[model samples]
Target: MTIKAVVFDFGGVLIDWSPEYVYRQLIPDEAERRWFLTHVCAMDWVVRQDGGQPIAEGTAELIAKFPEHEVLIRAFYERWQEMIGGVLDEGAATVEKLDAAGVPLFGLTNWSAETFPYAWETFPILRRFKDIVVSGRVKLVKPDPAIFHEMASRIEPHLPGIEPHEIVFIDDNRKNADAAAALGWHGVHHTSAAATEARLRELGLPV
Candidate 1:
């Protein structure tokens, strides 16, 4: 089927988000920083925050588990904005191009509901999306079919019975791309703006 809308993943794909960016400022020691992130402020713990867990509650839980790293653990949420390096210009330009071409744009991101305000406030380009399904808001993260289905379902209210197959989903992770592909959506495992633009052109988009 022909593509109708373009769905984008936020972190790593559209914007540069990494816990290390925040931790590097707090913990100056390289090896110690890696260990703290790996063991204390692990991705597993942060993903829970992405799935709607309160940052305060999550930080408390981590601090309880590792009392010695209290300051560092709190910094994870206290300085969450520092984690995002800023929007990736190359990738964001594709989004802008698609928007200018009158293509429907949407975002499907795994981000903390508590911290998303920082991004929402920081980046003006993000406002261009017609709609966005944040995993934190819905308590559902991708690679799960539920999140994909939820996003697809939401689109119907706007587009009136648009099928999942009509959306082109772009993500940096292969598994997330594969999951959307399984649902009959066109999935682009994005590496760079040039490659994504090429794919869009192949799909006959005006971009």
Candidate 2:
């Protein structure tokens, strides 16, 4: 099938965001930071916020569960902006290339509604995409077929009757890439900017 649009997963692919950035400075000890992140401010816990749980509510609930770590828990959301490392140059360049080539661009990201505004305001490259489907906005995260379906529905207004096979999805997580592939779309597991761009070219995209 001829590809008609490019769907990008913003966090790992185009933007460099990791909780470690915030914790590293606060918890200088590597082991302690790992322990805190793994047992307390875990990925699962963070995903809940990405799925639409209010940031304040999530933070309060976490502090309640680990009263001793109140300060740490507060820091998680308090210093959330530090987690965004900024737009990745090489990766974002690919988006620019595609856009300049006249390819339709869109974004699908698992980001907290409460925090995404910071990045949205900070990065100009993000604004290039014609449309974006944010997990927090819709309360559905990636790897869940529902989120991809939501993306498809949103893409309809721009590319009418577009099929899954006609879109290429780029995600850094293998699970997300596989999930989209399972749904019949061409999913590229982005390991690096060079690799992803190579794969996109192989898929017949101008970039």
Candidate 3:
């Protein structure tokens, strides 16, 4: 298969982000943190923000529903930066190798519009992408074919006449990777940095 450029999914693929990072400090008790994440600040609710819901609105809605855990709910977004540990070591290293090899890298991420700026500001790796299509800014989250198409559109300008099959997409989420595959884009499920690098090499990419 002829490949044009490789697209990367941000959070799990490159950045080490999780609510657990901050919650471990705030909640203290593992069991209670688990319950709170499961019952209150569920991933679905968090994902809504990723798809463009205002942070204030999301936090307020959750706070209203679970007034008993108001402090915990508020801390979800208020301390959003704390949830990020840093760039994944292997992933960052892999990106650097790819960059040096002149691979065309691009980003497609399900990140909140409000919070994505901080990452963009801090991580030089993210700046390596020729362009990035952020879910929150466009109101289109992944696993939805529309967002993948949006990525394709953004990529067209840099690598003209590129077809879906010519692009390789790497994502940590199997579902999102599968979605890209369904659209005829080659999908690499990023389980580990080593695995992702190997997969890209198999695809004839520089990495």
Better of 1 and 2 by TM-score: 2
Compared with the true structure, what per-residue lDDT tens digits does model 3 show for residues 20-70?
A: 989998989999989989989998898899999999999988888989999
Please give the clash total of every predicted structure, in order.
0, 0, 0
Q: Pick the candidate with the highest lDDT.
A: 2
Arrange candidates by lDDT, highest first: which order?
2, 3, 1
Off by over 4 Å in 1: none
Q: List the residue pairs that clash in candidate 3.
A: none
lDDT to native, each model? 0.88, 0.93, 0.91
**Global local distance difference test of model 3:** 0.91
After superposing candidate 2 on the true structure, give the runs of residues whose Cα lies further than 4 Å from its correct spot. Answer: none
Evaluated against the true structure, the overall lDDT of model 1 is: 0.88
What does candidate 1's lDDT look like per residue over 18-49, in tens digits? 88887877888999988998999998898899
TM-score of each: 0.94, 0.98, 0.97
Error of 3 at 113 (Å): 0.3
With candidate 1 superimposed using the best TM-score fit, by how many Å does residue 67's alpha carbon deviate from the native?
1.3
Off by over 4 Å in 3: none
